[model samples]
Target: MEISKNIRESKKNILLLANKKNKGHIPSAFSIINFVYLFYENKLNINNDFILSKGHGCLALYSVLEHFNYITTEVFFSFGDFDSILGGHPHLRKNNEIKASTGSLGHGLPIAVGKALAAKINQSSKKIFCLIGDGEANEGTTWESAILADNLKLNNLICIVDNNQSQNRSIPTPNLQKKFSSFGWDVITIDGHNSNEILSVFNLNTINPLCVIMNTKKGKGIADMESNFQEWHHKGITDNLLKLYIKEIHEEAIS
Candidate 1:
């Protein structure tokens, strides 16, 4: 419940900021917050490695970082603007806390796979986590990386797909879990909006690489936005709408 509350609150504020900044990918940002929060709070090997392959959802990562004091409030407010450390995507050079610069889609997974392989060879306990989008899974390289992860049995490596149906103007129509299963991955599917369900996916430990397919709405938690794919995906955040939405989110967060 705390994780859900954090996801809801962080997502609301991130959307408010996105609206003020006229940003895109606001819903994707909301959809991944809980996983991001959980990775930071409980799952990830923070001192080691992690990747946000779905870099459009960087707002979720940034919100968690800002919440935890990895960056300043001024930097967060200035996101997407010039000279701000927080860009629309994660950049490791800008902040040491960011494990990788991940706007390139489909690239982070292979890289994480390499790291996991290296760690396994070196007999290191460190691990790698990569969060990607279902839409981004359309990339051929992502599947190639999945095959490698499975063949090598990189159990220390974990990847999550934000299966939010819609991607770049079209919703994903294919069976995501089936695709991963065919790749020989240990696949699990769950409701992304439910914190408990998300947490359960995190509990999976396997001899092969794991791929979690999270079924999420593009714009979850916002009354006018959840699955409304048309209005809020990449629009300018109006001040009026921002205020109303924030108020609504806060009320829902506490309830």
Candidate 2:
């Protein structure tokens, strides 16, 4: 796999975090953890905000947040527990580093559009970076927000689509780059699992609202989960299965 230690750890962390309370969208988290981990690893400029719009992947966010000390290890461990701030979604953790309470699929982009517009109006140097799932693209709000962002000339807004295509069986969004370009966004597609590609794309300076379509597989790194991710989407992991996943991840990452 040639993945970074952070990626391996973050993947393992999500499993451990989910196994603790028998909760979490592990496959969803796995699909985007690398991006999230890299976002923190690079210590991305926070002049604005980063929204994990696909909030079912909270375990991935929490895992990297802990790794980067955005949230304490204690808080990370309290995931899905009684009286805990961490839940299956970020809507509950208003006090944490989270910028928006996301979970309801299509809301984050609209909110991001609002933030980027506000930044433009105030003449601030803030750039709003948002990560949305391919499935979330099925929502009208996603397209509406994109159109509005481009109309406003929101070069400060960067939207990254986690195009894992986990929802293709329902409604597939074919030619995402073409679609975003038609809406006036500068588009770039990349290998989502490749760290070098991830960093290169994120570093690019855009002249218009940008749409980065990161091609990825659901439940990446682990072959078993990657093959049948629908079953693992929100499944509670048994201890045996968890061990198997950990071992597989280690073998792949080390190979």
Overall lDDT per candidate, in order of appearance = 0.78, 0.84
Distance from true location, Cα of 77 in model 2, Å: 1.9
lDDT string, candidate 2, 1-255, tens digits: 424766888788877876776878888888788888778777774555788899998888898888888788898888877777887789634544687899889988999899999999999988888999999999999999988998899998999999998886788888999999999999999888888888886678789999999988888888877999888788777899889988887765521
Q: Judging by TM-score against the true structure, name the best candidate.
A: 2
Model 2 residue 208 CA deviation (Å) reads: 0.9
Instruction: Choose the strongest candidate by lDDT.
Output: 2
Which lDDT tens digits does candidate 1 get at residues 169-255? Answer: 765538877888888888888777676787776557787788888887776667787847666767767889888877777676421
Q: At residue 49, what lDDT does model 2 achieve?
A: 79
